[model samples]
Target chain A: MSKSAILRSSIAKKYWMALTGLFLCTFLIGHLIGNLQLIFIHGEEGRRAFNEYAYFMQHNIFIKVLSYVTYISILFHAIDGLMLAVQNKKARPQKYAYNNAGANSSTASRQMALLGSIVLIFIVTHMVNFWAKMHFEHIPLHTYEVTLPQQTNPEMVYYTHNHSLIPIQVDKVVVVRDETNLYLENTDLKLGEGYKDLHSVVMAFFGQSKNGFVTNSLALWATILYVISMAVMAFHLWHGFASAFQSLGLRHKRYTPIIAVTGKLFAIVVPFLFAIIPVLIFIGYVK
Target chain B: MASKTININLKIWRQKNANSKGSMETYKLDNVSTDSSFLEMLDQLNEQLVNERKEPIAFDHDCREGICGSCSLFINGEAHGPDRAVTTCQLHMRKFKDGETIYVEPWRAKAFPVIKDLVVDRSSFDRIQQAGGFVSVNTSGNTIDANAIPIGKAAADKAFEAATCIGCGACVASCVNASAMLFVSAKVSQLALLPQGKVEAQQRVLNMVKQMDEEGFGNCTNTGACAVECPKEISLENIARMNREYLKAMVSAE
Candidate 1:
């Protein structure tokens, strides 16, 4: 009898919110660490590292489970948050004639619904830009240009996607159109495959490319939007991180201050690093 | 502080009844004593209105010393006026500038509708209390001695602190969401700590929170506004404790 009542209450919804919120916070850390590989390691190695990480994230069974959990977390967080916001709004049907909300609370804490909704939009656009393309479309394979002393021109070389030592010569295999398959030239028989060049897609996202400059007007706008969204994300986390702890009833007199400080620090540092990634790529500093 | 007086402007909310619409009416009271309590100053305004054959501005006040939880007012956009850690009746005129205008209104919340002017129907709190705010102790002649039950000093002190909540609804009035979480949490915490109340701890928290939700009060977002504006300076820890207790009950349930 009381079990359904517990689930239906505002506090129970917050319990779910706090649990999912904390889970997502951990996800942010993992995501940021993987993304930092973009700027931390330079040249082909960095590209290989990021692409390898992406491949591992996609192919690993454990990560696949975690990815599903992530998707569920995002959906549940957004929907539950929306429901709470609507309910909370209805709690005060009549607006005060004069309210000095600033005198008592933070602007970020008060505007969480707005900030979260914006972050939701950014997440949608962000998934469409990167996740959709990577998961659904046929992206180019990673191709390396290898030069030999006997050849005046550098030959096109393709490495196996499994990080194997074998390299395929350009003339030895026929490249399929808009696909990653490598076929024997003038024959129906197939050679192996090449790695999906997610590295190139990410690099070119901000106009810089492996080959040269590509004039993508969206690059500047995307960088700006990403940085702004990261800032909004930071603001969201500023109130949210420790608030999750409080909501979960983990607050202790000895540890709450530390948690509060760590929450603020986490809020600022993680987003700053994430924001810096695209900025560095756009400005050619990390390219 | 000798015989101080100051002239000030007032914008007080006035409503004929619950069905009638309210409006802020302006009044200028000259030579008001700075030594007067905020309620006393309002009494002065009421006296002036009576002399002019106008209806006296309706407001709520009782026990004028700030513990009855009756004198609820939002002054200058603050619950219980601008001064911290004090109720409206405890607020004095010396805190205000001589010529500055003061805004006065009732406690604002969906559960706490304005009765007339500064009086809000805080009976929602009473209803929540009625739900499960009490311990089911047999009051027969063979009641146990107070010292028979051993309680840790920490638990006793903490329970005392939670018990200090006067249910003024300042927490709701000052909260951006108008949540009554602090008030409910205090009630839950006070009883939940004592051994006598521990018999019904799970059900008490469950029923109280259920009634609290039924009251249409908003959810607590942990802004600390309620604790800041509370006349008793209730800690946010009580709300957290209530959350813990409520979760424990639910998880341990069949």
Candidate 2:
């Protein structure tokens, strides 16, 4: 067969689905690892680690290329699925008078399109909420205080113009608000410079005030929605992970059961971890 | 086994031709023996219609056994009736109650157009098989010793399992998308697994898959109804195996 014919064929379309689906799964793992920092790291240290990680991801050339690939993969997977579903509907133009499809196939397998759409919506909302704000919109800089070693009575002070790195005496320690610009150049510490503190944004979005009241009802709702979206993601992955291998023609009786078990574990664990982040933040466990 | 007879109402789809409009025609069948097969019951109904000087309800059946893959009916919202793992011919009237009303219709797929009443032209499946369902062997007097090629038990069993597919359009009929992946995969896997067939496996998969697409069948989303509705109990694993074979072919071709 010709190359175009191979690609345009139904099996080729399924190959695209499987390839893109597996790629997205990898992206989810990386994303979940990044997000885990928000829960494991605490206080200013956690904030700085997450912010630096976010900054590195935003500026790194390799990561930029991966991000574009991720975007394209997401688009291709969604479009391919939509086209397949539409064609499927056309194939059966006349609906069955009675259908008990549930008896044969799984609920998850049957509802893949619906589950995928929900996840798609979640991706859009997530990108708009965090990614858009970090990249496109002007966001306020986060400020935090840190204790620093200072000169009590220095003879000579050798420092850069921004004073991001200050020469200090060994004897004296002073508590001061550390506003060092770690990512960008020519920035003032007092005025809060550099990239948006996405870590702080995440915290504020899901965090509650000291009085046990939510900072914003919208944030609470978004958290709830985020959790539900994770549930949807879990269900999508439950079928998708194993189906991907099948689509790729990786079926082996000895190893297929193992792959299926691993896929199921990944499907449940990844989404559960992601969902817990918002829950922990909402309850003031990770503030 | 002792058998009882029952009377029941049947709503069967009737269409004159592919281009003609189709509708449900009702018939009341009495004293249908529980031991009689579903198709036999239909035969009784047709006999009644014939005696009444009306057109006998048109349907398809050859062997009157399940192996021919000629019989197809969507009964009560399921392919081959409510019974699991049985074709319409294998289904018995005892499964239905005396007063129950059963709905029977032709497979609703664009590719398998209704010829008349319960008969559909499944030539699309034949074309897909013709595309690459065979291995080219030198048929001249130089036949190789069959026992000389030692095949593994597992590979042989898997190949035999896939070979059981009767090309029944149930996979297409039961599929929500009307995808023929199951049927195509069964044929592809049956040949791809054996050593004798592996020489032309690449071309076989490529040709069959292309033909399947040309037939305007829907893409497989792995909803899995095809394997379940299959009277032969063909496994979904065949589909996966074909997928692997196709991928291997595509890569090798490049």
**Best by TM-score, which number?**
1
Tell me how far candidate 2 lies from the true structure as C-alpha RMSD in angstroms.
3.9
User: Tens digits of per-residue lDDT for model 2 on B180-244?
Assistant: 99999889888888998898899999999988888888889888899889998899899988888
**Could you tell me how far off, in angstroms, the CA of residue A199 lies in candidate 1 after the best superposition?**
2.0
Q: What would the TM-scores of all predictions be?
A: 0.92, 0.88
Task: Look at candidate 2 and tell me the lDDT of residue A135.
Answer: 94
What value does the lDDT take at residue B72 in candidate 2? Answer: 91
| Candidate 2 local lDDT, residue A236 | 92
- Compared with the true structure, what per-residue lDDT tens digits does model 1 show for residues A143-239? 4332334553345554455566455565654555325655656755445455676777888897677744254678999999999999999999999
Q: Which stretches of candidate 2 lie over 4 Å from their true place?
A: A42-45, A145-195, A207-217, B140-150
B168-187 in candidate 1: lDDT tens per residue?
99999998888999999999
For candidate 2, list the clashing residue pairs, or say none. A98-B77, A249-B244
